[model samples]
Every structure is written in C-alpha cells, then in structure tokens.
Target: MPHDEAQARDTYACRLARSLHNQVSTLLGNRLAHLPGRTTPPKSVHTTQLKMALAETVFRKVYKLGLVPKIIAKLPVLSLMLAVISVCWLLILPMDGQFRHTYISENALMPGQVNLYFRETEWNHVRGFRDEAAKWDFESASRSNPQLEGWLSDFGLKVSHHHDPQTNLSTMYALMHAPRGDNTEAMVLVAPYFTSDGQKNVGAMALAPALARYFARMSIWSKNIIVVFPQNGHTALRRWVDAYHTTLDVTAGSLEAAIVMEYPSEIDNFSFMEIVYEGLNGQLPNLDLLNVATTIARHENMQVSVQGTAPQNLHKNDYWTRLEVLARGILKLAVTGVNGKLHGCEAFSGWQIQALTIKAVGTGGPDITQFGRIVDSSFRSVNNLLEKFHQSFFFYLLLSPTHFVSIGTYLPSAAVIALLFVVSSIYAIARGVSAADFVASIGSVLALFFGIEAICLVGAISLQHIAISGTESSGAFYVITAALMLFTVLSSVGIFAVKAPRFSRPTSFLLLAFALYFIAMLIVTLLIVHFALAFCIGISAFPLTLVQDLITKTHGNTLVSMKARVKVVLCLIASSPVTMIVLLGYILDGGKTEGVLGLVQGLLSSWHEMQSWTWFVVALGWLPAWISVVVVCAFGDFTSLEKEKTE
Candidate 1:
C-alpha cells in the first residue's frame, strides 16, 4: 500500500510540470484551506509559540480571576482587624470612671506622691470650698476666676484659654514645666468652668480653683501636666484636643491617659459615688489599674460599665464589693447618644482621649482637695516611668473583679464572619467562570450595592418626611425600594449593552469603589445636625462598606432568585417576630437610653445573624439560582463552560 501511494505522489510533482502543477495546486489549496494541514499553513511559526500564546492568554484570564481572590482575601483580614480594634479600643482607652485615661507625653510628671500631705492637709474645707464655688454659674465662675491661670503660670506653666460659643463651651488650659532644679520633664494641665446648678464644691469656686491650680506644682512629678477644661461640650472639647495634640508630634504612638473632672453636678454627695467608665465598645480598664483603684478608692467593689453591660451590685471575694450599675446611667448616655462625658467630646475629634470622672461621695466626705489629691495621686502613679500598657489585656470580658477574657480568649465572634468570606473566595476561583459571566456577576454586585444604597437613602429621606410631618416616620422605607429597582434596571442594562466591552472593567470597579467610599464618608459627615443623632447615624451608616466587596462578590444567582427572595423576605419577617420587632418598637419609643442600648445590642446581633443567614443562602441556594439563570441565558455567553459543552 505504501509503495503504490509513494509512486503516485512522486509522479504528481509540482516541480516536474509547472502549468499543470499550478492548476492542481490552486484547486488543492482552495479545498484544503478549511482543513487542519501543514502544506501551505504557517509552518515557519513554532507550535510552541502558538502554545505559549494560547497558554499566556489562558494564564492572563486566570491571573485576572486571581485578582478578585487576592482582593477578597484582604476582606477577611481587614474586617477582622477592624472589629478587633473596635473591641480593643473600648478597653484601657479610658472613660468616666474612678479615673479617665489621660495622656502623659513625658515620663516624669508624678501627680500625687509628694509630702503635700493633702490627706491631713485640711479635709474639712472641701465642702466649704465646693459650696462657695457653687455660688456662681459657668460664666460667673469663669469670669471671677482669672487667677486660675496665674496660679498655673506660677508653677512655670505656659497657659492658653479657649472660649467656645457653640454649645456655650469654655476651657482653661496650662502646661507645667519640669522642676527647675530637679526638672523631671514637661507635662500639661487643664481645668475649665465646672457649672452645675450655679455652684461649685463648698467654698472652692473663687478661691479653690486658684489654690487647686497650685496642687499641680506641689505634685513633684517629672512630666508636665496639661490640665484643661475642654468644654463648651463634646465638640468644643474635641476641637481643643485636636489643637492640643496637633501641637505635638504627628505620628502614631500611645497617647498618655487623661483625667477629666465632673464635679459640676455635685450638690451634696451620696454614698460612695459611682465611677462611670465606658470604653469605646465596652472596653474596660487595665486589670492592674482596676485592682489598684478598687483597693485605694475603698469602693474597689463599686460598679463598672463596659460597652453598656454592667453587672448590678457585683460582689467579688466578699471583701471588695463594687456596685455594677446594670442600668447604665451616664455611660449609657454616651453609648446611646447622650454624651455624658464632660470632656469625652474631644475623643471623637481625633484626640485619643479618655477620662475619669471622680466625684466625692459619703454624705460629706473627700472634699475638692481630697478628690484632687486622689487624681493627683493616680496621675503621679501613672507618671512613674513605664512602657506602654501593652503587657496587660487590651481586649477582655468582665465577669467580675478577678476574672477576664483576653483578646486571645474572645476572638471567635469576629472570626466567624471572616470564615464565610474565606470559603466563598475559594469557590469563585475554582469555578473558572468566563469573562462574560464575570461581568454578569459584577453587574449583579453593582445592582446589589446601588440597590442597598438607594434603599437606605430613601428610608432616610422618608424618615425626614415623617420627622417634619410630626416627629417620627412610619411604614417601610419605600424610597429605598424605588431606588433599588431603578438602579437594578440601570445596572442590568449597562451590563447588557454593546458598550460594556469598551470600558476597562478593573478601572471602572476601582473608580466606583472610590466614589462610593467618598460618598459614604460625606453622608456620615453630613449627619452632624444633632451630635447625638449624628453619632448614632454615623455609626449605623459608616461600616456598610466595611465588608461589602466580599459580601457582594459572594452573591451568585441564588441570592436574586424568587425562592431566595422569599427566603429573604421570610428572614426579614422572622427577624421582626423574634427580635427585630421588639427592638424596632423600643427604638420607636424615643429618647430611652436603656431601651436604645438594649435595642442596639439586639439589633447588632440581629444584623450579624442576618448576614450569616444570607451567607447560607448564598452558598447553598445560589448554585441552583445561578444554574437556572445560566440555562435561561445560555445563548448570552453567560452559562458555565461545562454546561455549554454539554448542550
């Protein structure tokens, strides 16, 4: 067979007969052009080159797909970190307790370790001084007390006074120098108008402020003390903190703890006064400090508050019995929009500020001097040279005085959310969806994101409508629904258009992310109409973009399905009956701090729960929905490659 074929091909050589060969070759070329052959094909090119090119293209697509995973991985790390930081920030960060966290730039300003002997140095006069000081209100007391400045200046202090018109806030500030001879180091000091029922301690408004100014000098500490009355409210206080801190180094470092006095509302005095400490997100004090303060204040057994959870009348070891006011009074106010922090307003203004509200108690005990001495002592103790408070627990849960859960102890709550993202990411990468499918997914994400934004906005506007109509808004947020529908339509059309291929997908997504983040921050900033309401709103609105990228990308077809919609609605409905309704009703009640706290805690938990439920639907139900969508859109280049092959 081979011999016969060879003989025939040799006989039909193009070189042998040119004209005859040309006619046959032309016909052969025309017919064979559609066949995969090498006679007239691009033979000079390396198959390796073609292989490499195809491989490169495949790799590029793979690489592009990997970009999403790389970005997605960050979702877990950042989200977990943020939630963790928030928790840590709540603790050791300081609050209205036996002492607040005050910043000491220098290591030397020992506050109360001297032979000033304030204990035996006139315990009786605190009441008289306090009563006399109470005679004048904030304005009168401030006007009458110019010497307060001169006194700090006498201690070799450079002083500044801030007069805030908004919220009618005023403050007096001074920084003490290191001792002239020993010259330990520099520090700051501040004391502003203490206005409560137009009265001070007993006899201190006019004279005690002047003399109280002297206590900083007598401290014999190393660091300078910047005592300030950052008032006019939280805003003014926050402004002052910004100005003050700006005057210092502009870098990330530990801010020394701060102390703020709130004797404004002290009329007489009850038993041991309550020390209200609310760390950022239910953070508590350092265990060492807690123990020390408890042992020293004699009310070590007094109540404590972290976040809004304070155990009522908590007793530990039978000896150290501190009252844990379960019903958060002042701390609750700060958490639920009632900023009871005299100087706490400054913390939000970019000053890592915390405070301690130590007021005198016990019928008629611990006058201004004693209270001042206690503060001075605590500050002096802090002044003792030491590294940052990194050794103790930064994140912990308070069960009692001695028991606590460390950061290592309680990371599970945040970890659970992060884990879901991890699983979703792995699946998206392995599926190897095509570019068109990718665009479809992204379009869906865009719809979802804009849809969410529209819903939230409309609800906000409608709420405003009701607020103006009477004071409260009713019914579901209709505007949000309309916005969602409109955006969904827009997104769907945009993805389906002939122009979709023109724009660089990555660039578009990047630009969109930037625009959204900016818009979010702007909306948050604009809520300053009512500081309290603004704070509440700002928090509620600020963190949506936190893990949004992860959440949106995880949405396959299951999320947008009719069945999924039913589940989502059922979730919404079930949420109301079980917990959301109760919370919604409570919040609707208005101005109820306790109710609000309870509601918020529940709502937060509920929101988290809903996210988990959504994740479940996404992972389990999304496949079915995605398959259905792909089947329906098979001709549109949106089906899975395997499905296309099978068809």
Candidate 2:
C-alpha cells in the first residue's frame, strides 16, 4: 500500500469525478431542453437524472428574462408619474401668478415707441365711410362692393376683387406699394365689412380704407400695405389670401404681418378692445405681434382684453377673475374649431404671416380715434421689422393681454399626455409578445382602421352634402344625424371586443394601443408643427388613453366580471368621442353666451363646411382611441376561453 497503490487510488478518484461531472451536465442540458419553448428530453432518461435536470431547468428559466420585458416591468410607473406631473404642470401655469408678463422679443419691433398720428382727418374719413356704408347688410354687401372698390381705387392704389363662386361672396382689397423697398414683402390690414351675424364692422371698414389712403401718401414705407375689405368673415379672407398666394395672377409678395380691425358699432367709442389672436384651428400670431398690439393699446390708455375679457382690477378677488379670463383665453385657443369672421387674423397665420384682431368691445367712449391710433402704432412697429416675426415666440397662451405662458412652460402637459400612450405601447410590446404576432396583429388592425376611416369619411361627406343641398330647416336634422352616426361608429368597437377570441385578444389590444400611440405621436408632431390643431386634438383624445389596460393583465380570465365591465363601460362612455364632442360643445357654447341649442347649431354649421378640422379630429383621432378602449374592455377572458377550447 505504498507509492504505487496511492497513485492508482488518486487516478481512480479523478476518473470518477470526471464521469459524474459529464453525466450531471448531460442531465441538466436534457432537462432544460424539455422545458416550455424547448425541445423535449428523450424517454430513456432515468428518474434521478430527470430530477436533477428539472432543478437546473427551473433555475435557468427563473433568471433568463428578455431584456425588453424586464426593462418595461421596471419602468411601468414612469408613464404614470409623467402623466401626473404633466397634468400638475397645467395647474401650475396659473397658480400664484406663475405666468410671466410678456415683453417684446424682437428689437426691431419697438412696440409703442412711435407716436400715433391717426386723428380728426382719419376720424372724418371713417365717419364718411361708416355713414355711406350704413345702408349695406350681408345681402347688399356684394352689390355695394364695386362702389367701395372704386373708392379704394380713387386713393391711387391698385384695387382688386376676390370672389368665391361657392359662397357667391366677394372680397375687395387695395395695394399700396412701398416707395422705399422693392415691395418683395408686404403687410396686410384686413377690415371685414360684414360680421358673422351679417352686420357691418362699420367703423373698421371706414378706418382701413382711410389708413390705406394715408399710408399710400407716406413715402417712408418699406413694405406694401394691402387693405382688405372682407365681404364675408374668415371665409372670404381665407379665399383672398389663397388667391394672393396661389390662385390669383398677382404678385403680392410674402406677407410679413397683418392687422384685422372689427368695429361693428357706429358709436365710434369702445370701452375696451379685445385682441383676438387665436386663429383658425388654434393658429396663433407671433408673440411680438401680440406684444406690439398690447403695447400700443396700453400707450393709448385703452383697456385691453385677451379673448375679450379684461381683468377690471388686480384686487385679490379680481386675481381669480383674471384667472378665469386667462382660462377662457387658453380654452379658446385650445378649441379653435369654429369659423368666425373675426378670426381673419388666424387665417393669415397659416400662411406664416403674423396677424391679430383688434376688436372694439363694450359700448361708448373709448373713442375709435384711440383704436385707430393703436392700429397706427402697431403697424409702425411691424414696418420697422427687417425680417419675419421669427425673433419672438410663435407659440404662447395669453392669460391677460400682458401675461402669457410660452411653449416651454405649458407644453409638458401635452407632451406628457402623448408620452403616456408611447410608454404604454412600448410596455405592451415588451410583454413577451412575439414580433411576428405583433406585426400580424398590427396588419389586421390596420385593415380595420382604414375601413373604419373610409366609412367615417363617407359619412362625413354625405352629411356635408346633405347640409349644403338641404334647406335651412333640414340643417338641424342633418347635423343630429351626423352626430348620431359619429357616436355609433365610435361605440361599435365594443361589438368586436365581445367577439374577439381570447388567444389573439392581447395582441389585438397591443395593436390597437400601438395605433393609438401612433395617433398620439402624430398629434404631438402636429403640436410641434401647429400647436392649436395638435393641442385641441391632443386634449380631446388624451383622456381615452387614460383607461386601464383592459386586456393586459387578464391572463387567466377571458371576460371581465360584471362589476369590472360596468367600470369599463362607464369609462368608455365618459371618454367617448361623442361625449367629448358634447362636453366641448357645451364649453364652447357656454362661452358663446348661447344656450345648448346654440351649441348644436354651431356644431351643425361646423359639420356643414366639412372644412373645420375640429369635428374630423374628433371623429377620426378620438373615435379610434375610444373604439380601441371598448374593444379591449369587451375582449373575452382568454384563460377561460382556452380552458373551454381545450375541453
């Protein structure tokens, strides 16, 4: 038992260890293979080996998480937190005087620095135009337009008429070329002759032509001044602007800025002036333009209002009153779905020209002379600009005429709302769903999405056509029909939810969520591009994304319980596009000083034009999201369905 025997024993022990290690390795590998999503182990494996293999397999499976799902699971709360913070940011926009007071950003726009020279001569001309124009209403406006055109031509300026055959309306304008510059850039002064109510902006129309004549005499001008006497409302201005840019054979050059004057009364005195900057579909003028207008108004000792309400005083009670005024301004910009003539300034914004409306509001003794001086001074500031109004903020929310919130301060709310959908869609995708399944599910839903879009488009077209072709009496019925159709289309998603199989339901939910997320992204992109359109769409549609993931955690259950179903139903109802329309209609209508029926009539008018993106965004963007939520809620309980199928 000496050295030779010891060597033999050591060698035998080494060999035994090697053999055991190989056998254990093989068993573990075979067990792992037999686990779910792996190849099955051979039948020849013994119980001891199988047990060892099973233990190793369990260990591996427990720790082998896919990177995406693991990351998503860790970050589910982020979206919620962002959403909460975003909503809170909105509240903070007004709390404790958080909004910053506005000042001019462009050095060239030296607001309120110029002394206004519009005086008795201008007033006399305005009076003459007002008195001469007092006989004209909407019906007679077209007939009298030639006379106005001739009068504008008498100022030795180039005059033109823009007529839209569809509405049988005419817009008359006169251009006075700049004596100093090449006339490559121009500024427009729009004076709507008729109000949306078919009355005349008597004072403004008179004032613009007089200003044009006065401006034509000034040899110091560096940009052409175009005086627009709009025959209709925003519609005619849109037409004229379109003609100047694309349709008409005229060289009006790039529009630098615009001023819209609406003085509907013959009193020649207004207590306050409302600065209407919110444009068509939420377009806004440059902050510089607003600042210029406000500065001039203030200099003239004129009380200024943003969206038509001026805080009477800064007293403690009036602080909340100011807040209400601010909220109204924000909401008006947020809900720019309607077409009113006073918003002609908004149409100019779409063409990249900064514009705003100076409407003389309230009755008696602010003096049209003061209003004219405000316009004169504001125009002088724009005339000083060497380039476009790009130096100042193109996106802002006016709290008062003097206070505002820029994009950086107020954008987080919309961004957070859009981002929630983004995070949720990513979370859904990360939930172990196969890429092919995701792709196939998305493809299926795309078909459904486009089909739904087609149906909606046809319905919209039919309603629009019916409204146009029918008499005034039938307009209400057609509008009601359109509203009902929209509701039905949105609510119909519940039908598919109740019918979709449990197996594919989660994937379907993911697809729909992704579609919704994409829509949100589009809205965000649009917000970046055009804040008003995007903001309105985002706010209206954002609530639909707030619903709990209806199909997400229902792994064992296919159908939700009756209680859960009720909650889902209620949520769907609350966030439905139809409901949003009604709520928005109420809010807008309330602001209109019109009752509920008035809102209905406005909605009908909006629907009839089919030009307003307000209804379409609701029907298309918000409707699909609503439908997706309903479908997810209606999904059968996959766990129970699978069990039933297997049985």
Candidate 3:
C-alpha cells in the first residue's frame, strides 16, 4: 500500500512540473511571435535579452544584500577620508618631487645674463644721496619735494607731481625715455618716501636717483624707466598709479613692471632681500618676474627670503621648515588678498603691471652695491621683455625662493575643501527633503536664509558707503557701531526664530543645507581669484558641517547632553568669522587690542580706497553662514520649550 502511494505522489509531481514547463514554453513562444510577414528575431537579440535578465537578477541579489544602502550610509565617512587625503596631498607638496623647481617661463627674461655695472661708484652716490635725504624735514614734506624734483631734473628726465586731496599726500615721478626705442612701454622704480614701517626710507630715496642716474646713461634700454617717490604710504602709491593711468600731467608708454625699493635704514648693508610679491586682491606678479628677481639676487651672492622665511632655512629644505614656509606663504597670501594692505607692490595691481617689493632685511651681509646690482639686473631683464608679462604663472605659492607650487597643483587643495562643503550640503539637502514637512521646511528655509542675507547685504552696502564717505576715525567708529548693531539684531532674530514653537527638524536641516551651499559657492568663486583666502576660509569653516549631525541627534531632546553642549560651543567658536579675525589679529600682533582695531581699520580703508571685497565677503558671505549654523545648532533643535508649552 505504501509503495503504491509513493508511486502515485511521484507521478502527480511529474505531471505538475510538466504542466508548468509547457505553460512557460507557450508564453515564451507567444511573446516572441511577430505579426504576419514580419522577420524572425535575431540570435543576438535573444543573447542580449538573456544577458540583461542575468544582470537584473544579479542587481536584485546585490540590492537585497543592502550593499548600496551601506555605501550611501558611509558616504560621509568616505567624503571625510577623501578630504583628509586631499589635505595630505596638499601638505606633502613641500617635499621633493611634489613641487616644481621654478624656471624662467618667459624666455625673454634672461636674468643675471648681463654684466651688472652698479658697483662702488654707484654705492658712493647712494651714500651721498642718503645723507642728503636724511637731512630733509620729512615731517612737513607734502605736495612737493624740491630736492627730489631737482635731482631727477638733473638726471635729464621729465619730472611730474600729483597731489591727492583725500590723503593730502603727494607723489613725485620722473620719466626717463629710452634713448633707442619708442616710448611705448615703461618700467617703474618706486622708492616711497616712507618705508612700510612708516620710517624714513633714506636708502631707497638715495638708491632711486642713483639708479636713475645710472639708467639715464645706459643706451641699451628699450622701455622707458620711471623713478617714483610716492609720499605718505601705500595710499599715496595707489593715488600715483591711478593718476598715472588716468590723469597724469606727464605720461609715458603703457606701464609693464614695477620694482619697489624699501631700504628704510640709512646703513647701506643688509643680510638678505625679502621679496614681497603678494598683491591686492590676491593678485600676483608674473612668476617669471619673481624668478628673475630671486635669480639675480642669488647670482649676486645675496641671500633671498620670501614671506618672512629666513634665507638660511630655505636651503636646508627641512620638512618642518618647508611646511612652515608653505603655511606662512598661504597665510600671508590670504591676509594680503583679504585686507589689500599696501605692501608697496600691491599698489601696482589692477593695471596689468607686474610689481614686487625688494626690501633690505637684517644688516651687514651684503652692501648696497649688491642690492643695486639685483635691481639693475632685474630692470634689465624686464627691459628685455617684448610684451606684457604673459608667459609665466600669475598664481603660485612659493615654498622657497627657489621652489614653488603652481596653480594647477595647489588649486585642487582648495577645490577638495570646497568639495567637503558641497558634500555636507548635499547630505543635508537629502535629509531635509525626506522630512515629513519638506515643502513647508523649504519655504521657511528660503525665507529665513534670504531674509537674513538681504539684511546682511544692506548692512554691507551701508558700511561700504560709510567707509567711502566718512573720515577714517568717524568711519571706523560708525562701522563698528553698525556692525555691532547688525550682529545684535541678527543674533536676536536667529535665536528667536529657532526657539519658536513651530520650528521643526526639517527647518533646521534645510537651513543648514542652505548655508552650506552658500559657503560652498562662495569658496568656489573665491578659488579662482584668491586661492589662499578660499582655502583658509574653507578649512576654518569646516567645523560647521558637524553642526548638522549634532542638531539631528539633539533636536526635541528635553535636556541636551554635556558632550553635545561642548560640541555646540566648539562649532560656534571654530566657525565664527569674528573669532577668526580676532585670533588672526592676535597671532599677527601679539594679542594687542590695537592690532585688532588696526586690522578692522585696514579692512575699512582697503574697501574705501581700493574697493576690495574683503569686507563684503566677511559681512555678507561668512558672517551669514556662521550665524545660520549658530542658529540651527545653538537654538533651533532644543524642543524643551515646545514640550513645556504643550504641558
């Protein structure tokens, strides 16, 4: 009986299997069947369909295994790893095989190829002029200097003067026509009456005329030479440059390059030549021009320093030293770009002029003769250029006077940092869109962000007008008061909005996402014109990204944990632009109150005089982003108030 039952079951199973297989075969045949007179499907089509089926099965299996979701979950970690890798890549650039050895890209710049004639004879003239300049009453000197004008006139050059009504300062410039060539291109020799430190620049004053006299005699020149003695400070230089471009009494050919000589000490000796090449708005002279100057200085047996790094340390190429130099270069570049402080060379920016400052550093290493030789050779190299500075890089970071990293290599550093912001923004946006109240959240976020940004924009415009219209003291006072008022108002609004009963998680996430997106865009925009500034701001503000996760975890909590509170404090401090500025001022000036005040004043002055965007960026871009983060993290997520109200 058992054997009969098993046989019956087996027969039934076989029959069922056969029935299913026949049905599947019939379905396939019907699906593949074409209309009357249609051609049969190709074997390749069947093969392709089979492959697609296999791929779909595999994909289903993978998806079921949750690999894709896992990867998506790990995206932030992956992004962090990439950001770290990018930073490591940037840090390693000072190592050998990382940065390129700087070369003269412009073949016309045959630096140090010509024999230098600036010797003891010129040194004697320099000393004599130094004594004569030292005797002048520089305190009352303005609008004109008969001694300087007479000296230039004696050199058989066209002398002219420009007075700026705003600063009540004067600029005296003399043009020396190239004896052999048409007055189509000119080089400048700037010897500001005062050094960057506000001391009497007797040595530069002396050197300018000596070089002018020496250049006057040389018939091998092609471009005309202009010796400028800009009085007051960098503002004076800017006035002169502006007038030279627009409304000068005497004009030469288009200006091509300028060399600012800064030898404040009456003594003729110096340890090294510190090259100041960073310009206004992060502008840089052509790389070839810097290369030419450094090469000539080195050839003349004069040590060369850049961005205040010691010349001796540069030769060692010690990893720490290189790193320090790299860091300093970036910091200085950022400061210069943001502040537009007059470093002599910065005055020549925005006019297609390649300019650098050669300041005599230390004392008793090389005499004035060697310095003069460097200047002379540099001018000769510039004189050889047939056109404007176009061959070499306009953007580069000097690891040392000899080595540098070009824009192509270093730009990725800032780009990667900016990418970090983008990733954070995308993550925030993804989470924001998934919230239950997405549409309402987006509307609120847009209104909140735009409203705050509009206020900031108005405030920035007002500060700019104040900076431009008011006197320095009154302008600074009003700016400070207005800034404080704006800060108070914005902080109150952010705090009040975030603490409101209707504020929700979606609103917080959307706000953060919007702020991050704004920052990312700002950094990317700045990267093109001011790489160091962009990188600095990017890294400094990266802590804001952490606030998003913190807010997510802490939102609606009755009591925030100590760890979360500490994190909130840290984020606030780290991402605060005001804190960064104050810290920078402290680092730069030893925590002096005056230093911070002076920095603020300098920003105002830069904006008023040169139309620099530093203040605008700080007021509109950075401060707004920071405030948004602060609002979301510090006040947006604590739902205890809502709980209390419900009770």
Q: Which model scores highest in TM-score?
A: 3
Indicate the worst ten consecutive residues by lDDT in candidate 3.
638-647
By TM-score, is 2 or 3 better? 3
Task: Rank the candidate models, highest lDDT first.
Answer: 3, 2, 1
* Candidate with better TM-score, 1 vs 2: 2
lDDT of each: 0.38, 0.65, 0.75
In angstroms, the error of model 1 at 323 is 15
Per candidate, the number of residue pairs that clash is 69, 6, 0
Report model 2's TM-score to 2 decimal places.
Answer: 0.78
lDDT: the better of candidates 1 and 3: 3
RMSD, one per candidate, in order: 16.0, 11.9, 9.5
Model 1, residue 246: C-alpha shift (Å)? 3.2
**lDDT tens string, model 1, 67-161?**
43344445545545644553443332222342222222233333333444555345454555555555545565453356455655665656666
> Which residue pairs overlap in candidate 2's backbone?
234-341, 557-637, 558-636, 558-637, 558-638, 559-637
- Cα lDDT for residue 494, candidate 2: 51
TM-score of each: 0.49, 0.78, 0.86
Model 2 lDDT per residue over 397-475, tens place: 7766777788888776777777777877765554424456676676666676676667767766665555455535645
- Residue ranges of candidate 3 with Cα displaced over 4 Å: 1-63, 67-69, 311-315, 337-341, 435-444, 467-471, 474-501, 555-560, 634-647
